[model samples]
Target chain A: MSGASLAIPDRLRLLRGANNEGVLAVVLLALIVAMSIANPAFFTLPTAFSILRSSIVPLIFALGVLMVIISGGIDVSFAAIAVFAAYTTVRALQSGTPDLGLIGAFALALLIGASLGVINGFLIAKFRLPTLIVTLGTQGIFKGALLTYVGSRYIADLPASMAQVSTTNLFEVSTPTGSAYLHILVVPAVLLAIGLAWVLRSTMFGRSIYAIGGDVEAARRAGIRVMRTQVAVYVIAGTMAAAGGMIYVIMGRSASPQILVGSELDIIAAVVLGGASIFGGRGSVLGTTLGVILVQVIYNSLILAGVPSAWQRTAVGVLLIIGVGIQAVASRRSSRASVIDETYQKQEVPA
Target chain B: MKLADPETKPLSRLNDSVDAGWTRLLGLGRIEGGVRRMLILVVVAFAVFAALKPSIFLSGTNLRNIALNSPEIGVIAIAMMLAMLTGGIDLSLVAMANLSAITMSTMFTAVAAGDPALAEQLFPVILLAGIAVGVLGGVINGLLISGLGITPILATLGSMQIYNGIAVAWTGGKTLYGSPSALTAIGSSTVAGIPILFYVFVLVAVAIGVVVTRTPLGLRIQLQGANPTAARYSGIASRKILLSTYVLTGLLSGIAGVLFIARNPTASADYGASYVLLVIVIAVLGGTNPNGGFATVLGVVLATLTLQIVSSGFTAMRLSAYQYAIAQGLILVAAMAFEQVRWRRRRRSRKPAVQPG
Candidate 1:
């Protein structure tokens, strides 16, 4: 599998292989070029940084969704988990728990998220209830509970550590037009992505994830611990969601219980558009990253491209349907079979 | 609660089609286990609420409000349940309802052109337009899923976004207030002490339920969901069934849309955004198998009543809607959990004998 052991043509072939990343890369490049032609400011370093800045939380959340999707399940409750966990931590800190440093607060958020995710895993793995229904139910339950029992108001004043962290900059550039700033916030998102990519690519646990997603019964037959893998998948998903929520709050220097209330479909759409299948068993971190960037660019730069924001949702939806429609047709061509046969075959080959 | 009461004229007179359909479903003697359980839950919820607030909870006005509020969610739930019955879900039905409602409301607004009196006269045309939009939306969903081979979830999710976006763009994300006066009258008025829309809902639900249990299309839908491979070998056209499944659900949405604009008097892109999950909860609580192939009309009907009572009971006790939301979630998870545990125990009990053998 090492690149060093392969010939030049083999390396090229590998680079141009079965993933959606290559197609996504080309589309992203074309969009960027088009946007630049439409508006010169769109190509600037400042614009790039701003796009990168705005996409941070969504990128984090998309990774979690990508994992869950690859594991043959879906998680709509991540948004709920994210806000609930982050809000709980922020509320506890606001309610007079002495400075439990930023690390402490983060750990608490992750812990709360993991515990909540355990509930999802338990119901799903033990009961085999449909993931969509379970998550949907919990989404309401988590948000409803937070608003009723916990505080619903925004906390603009945070603990000193969180307050200071929001202002910390990794670097900044001055220009005649607009300044380009890279906040320290980029580090965590980058680190988390790298860590997740490595775990998903190199670890046995990662392989188990792919296995289970490909076929749960087959994975069990092949000696993988399907239940344990599934539980861990949800836990990791919850923790990442919590991280996304915390990132969102810290970036804005304010925490609200209602943050990210209805953003699940958007994130899931991004994951699927990245070449992940809703039926499960195939996705790549690289594809997801590009998918996030593609969706973010379209969403952020529509105005620059001379489109009104009112049409943004329509644009995204059309693009998604067109994108997935192509994949569906291509798969059908490869196997002349009925609907049931098609679904069954997809789980087997995963491409 | 006058839910089953016949204070007005005979219910059969409302829709002849529904009356014919009823003959097919009413003859079944075996009660599904899930339906029986759901009925118990409904009765329990009703009894508890009636006992707690005998004065106001069971009052005619409050009971009337429950019946009035029930149809919108109830009709939409039927659509959701039908989709799930075929092993798919239409996440866009809520959006479909909105789009169709918008189409209907826009017609009323455009035709009337400030003549509220004239808008009242174009009722039948406007109602048909609303349902037509729903059918159009469903056709698109069907094409994507069955024609293009896209999975139903992705297909519906994408369509939901598109439909919702179009509605938002058209209305600039604001409420386009103005339904036909006739529709508004239907929404607000009661006939012989019962809401007219309630009659529509019951008629529609019973008609569809009968068709689901009695017709070839209904049996084929269940067969496909129950075992797609077997259905395929049996020469059932999965594509046609899937398409018809969505189309039928769409037709229901159109009906719900007419009811929606009538009830709300305004059409908007983002109305009832929260109802998606609640609809799914209702469908599942009614014993619609999320994995597909099995569902019950009586069960779903009772489950809707149960939740409405529980939600209305919270109001009567001065409790917040959020608490009721939590209860909705708990009821679902707890029910599934109990089902899972009982099955696990049964399987465990059988394991010892198999090991010895």
Candidate 2:
């Protein structure tokens, strides 16, 4: 082959690696312009802030799920935990406990989330049960707990601080149509995302998760505390879910059984669409954030275009299929090429 | 391990020859044979239900109702068992059932609108549509999983959304109901004081059992599931086998869809959503290995009956539907947990290793 042609695969590999974030950044920009075209009202700071605000729960979920998925175990019950946390938070606020105030309630919920996660980790690591079955089992348990605690009763009339932080706006930003307000909640949410990204990219513990996902036995043999890492991953996942749950309760001003119904799938889809491997070993928090934004943009654009609510699931479902299909195809090609390269190298060796 | 004893083999062989021997008459040695534990659990469940609610559980009418109401779920569970036996899962089974049922219902509606008198004549069309929808879904699953080499669970998950979304979008979120009388009769009408669907499940179970035990295709499929590398090295086209397994699963799911719609007579978007877990539970309980390639069709059928009886018995005893749902979920968790413990115990008993190998 010619030198240029021989470099094609190398170029393709480089493009695959480096072009993911760039492509997503471009997609986000395009979506903003397209959404604005559909409704000039969509270009306002209020709409942007609202989208960012709406994104926080899923973003938190995505961050936690990223670590678990990278560590080679999935927590499908995170969504259920979110519902339970939100319900508990709302009830605590409603009951007006003096000892367990808002901060105490939040901390208590986080502890519950961590405990549940640890329980999940213990079951999987100790019993060696398949992650899918274990998670499915615990999902039922948590759902049962939520039902027992909430009893079909929703807690309303949140404390003023919680309500204000959830709904109040920062200074307005000018738009083509009109100036609009930005929410204060996005500030903390962004800070949380940034902090998570730092932990994932810079911490040794985070690196261990990636290593474990790559090869569990190898990591174990290399002196990594595999069980401890797994437990930590699940605990963080749970904590993030609880955080998201409380934020969701504050924003929605209510808690219901169906609050987070079937949301785990969406969170997973976001993670995968963001280029996180389902098989684990690799994922990026930055990419996950963009993935969340992409999903919101798609959702918001559909509404702005007045495509009708019934068609929304269908559209998103189609997008999921297409996105997964592309990933499948790309991975297949890379693996095939790698196999070929291995064979060629083997043949060249002194056998 | 005791069941696989070398000493018992000689006695077991002798008992097989002495057809009317005292040991055989006592049902003593048979407990050592295929899926005896499952059979015992099922028998105990039946006895308890019969004793607790004799008026409801053991009655012919109630039995028939239980059989009729659950056959579709049972049928799909059998399909799930087959896929699981091949060391893979078809998460799209529920979605496939939904799509197939919707297709059949939609087709029936189309035919009835053309000629109201031709309503009964469209039964075959509905059946064909159901099977066709299932096959198409299976093909997509097989192509992605086998051809493209995607992991079965993830691949089937993607297929689930695509299949279900199409069904919903095709119908515009509307339920297609009031199907032809003949179509509904498949579920509603009884033959010889038994629901037709029960017989259908029995035949399916027998057919699958025979195929798995007696046919090369079935043998190869299981082999591929049990040990893919070895099967491929032995000159078996493992991919083709995997593909066929998914297609068969899809076909059975389609049949289930037709039966499900007939029983309900209302094909909503949620037609098969709640059945996914129930199907898995029945399949796993029946003797299918959730991880891969080991199952008994007979075990699945029996487990389906036992579970259906328990749920129906609960309903008969004035328990609310939510209670039944909760009980079902708990039983499912218990069953899976029990299986996991059994598996770990067995593994622990095997040759111990110091490392991952």
Candidate 3:
């Protein structure tokens, strides 16, 4: 943010953009070093792969959350969207089209997820209602509808496509403790992250999202379709959440409606940790990826460090507060300049 | 859609603040249009359900059951309303309540040691300790938001995790029994077919009603939520008021904790996970604004009762528990959407969206 005023070179400005990632990487490294000194088992290849495997689910979910946050809205209903889309898709495939295969499964999941995303998008963009409230209501409705209309029972009998992915590990290593297997989904997750960074950095839709977050009226005045862009952002979030759910099912070889609905807070914490502003306007894929990994590490490693696993909740809360607090304070400190600009712009308007 | 907002006219907003301030100084609370609407909804719901199942829905046992379940959620809804009145919310209230209840429940076991005689004497002190836990938890949330400028939702979200963690860790993920017999008796006892616990909820609601409408703190909260900038310009200490608002929420949660343990034999971390949705629904249905600055206690109370009836009716009607979530979510969404309709109509007509009787 300070780079805006400085006579910094282009490369240096890019480095400034990576400041959040840099800090997170440092914290993560320090934590890893400390954990290694405390328990040698923590820094092993097996542990690394285990953490990586677990991260795929939250990372996908976090990417979508990162999108909504950048557009300056919150979606607490992603968990509901995830389970609702995934479980319904599984049930749909199992009932009739088991032959649709993996591609069909993903296509079906994305469609279902996107359709639901349309609800959030429509309500938010059309009514201009607060995103948090809309999502909270939908969270209940989606989860309830899933249990009421669809079956609440877990389905372990997955389609050949989903079950096959679970077994399609890139590599498995046998350690004294257990075998560590990296899932095939990790590559896609990385690809998605890179693709998202490109889109958010270079695409008009992505820049419009940032503009909307920064100032909706200003964006509208600048010929950015604010409402339409807001709707699209939520749609993207929904589709991503659905993809996350399918990935989760593919990894576990099961579709359980109840297992993933409560994990939104942790994912949100990770997203915020990665440098996305909760109030909106700015975020990065790299920062979010680091955040997801770091949060997952804290959640998984606390128990290894002799702290009770239950304190993972506390860790998430603390990380979220610290992460949000840093940005909030910095923004507040720099708000004076924006206040002057706002007045200057106001004077130009024909009110 | 954006142009429909009434907030565009600064001159009108100035009149609103000045008018509300004068009304508040006179100690006469402004009756928001939402309270009337919620009251109507409550009546309509009760009438519809009663007409549908006259024998079962209006039965003494069913009525008592509804009353029994109303207090815990009602108390939490009030906490949520106070936060909403400031355009903030306390998601951590439930976690804080659980922590408080667990604190008391475990302490009861420690002090009583299976002796009912000693349990009676130690109950009051132990209960105070539980409330103190909630108060302390609220203090942490207050300090985080009002002191450090964290957003209320994120701040409470964090506090919720921390509080829930402590409760879960302290309970070791197990349900602990042995609350004081006095609490159990109060929980189980009834007054004219209504649970004594329901009266406690009513008492809390009424007390809060007075505090919010009559007290200087209440006026400050209204002003702060209405416009933080205006409040600050008027010399109202925004931080202090925000701190007290959360603290009040905490106190309500603490009291709620006592009632929770009184009703149940045990306290655990995961109790009432569903209440999060129901509580928010009640607060919103009660006409509590999500943007802060407006709420009504009686409206929240009515909403709680209305939901309790809907829940009990669901059981009587042989519906699944999950359906209630849909009903609640639909109710909230419908209410918000209804607000939008009225707002648009009023904006289009350039007049208050008055409904004819």
lDDT of each: 0.88, 0.77, 0.87
**Chain A TM-score compared with the true chain A, each model in order:** 0.92, 0.89, 0.89
Q: DockQ of each candidate's interface versus the true one?
A: 0.68, 0.38, 0.57
Candidate 1, A198-305: lDDT as tens digits: 998999999898888889999999999999999999999999999999988888889898789898999999999999878788898888888889988998788776
lDDT tens digits by residue: candidate 3, A145-164: 99999898889889886788
Candidate ranking (DockQ, best to worst): 1, 3, 2
The lDDT, on a scale of 0 to 1, for candidate 2 is 0.77
Computed on C-alpha atoms, the DockQ of candidate 3 is: 0.57
Q: Between which residue pairs do clashes occur in model 2?
A: B85-B293
| Candidate 3 all-Cα RMSD | 8.1
Of the two candidates 1 and 2, the one with more favorable TM-score, higher being better, is 1
Spell out the clash pairs found in candidate 1: none
> Can you tell me which runs of candidate 2 are displaced by over 4 Å?
A1-19, A26-47, A99-101, A159-161, A174-176, A347-351, B1-34, B53-62, B316-330, B347-357
Higher-DockQ candidate of 1 and 3 = 1
**Winner of 2 and 3 under DockQ:** 3
Tens digit per residue, CA lDDT, model 2, A160-270: 656666667767777665667676666767887898878877888978898998899999999999888887888788888888887788778766766785767768877
Which 10 consecutive residues of model 3 chain A have the lowest summed lDDT? A10-19
Error of 2 at A146 (Å): 2.4
Q: After superposing candidate 3 on the true structure, give the runs of residues whose Cα lies further than 4 Å from its correct spot.
A: A1-19, A172-180, A332-351, B1-31, B114-116, B351-357
Highest DockQ, which number? 1
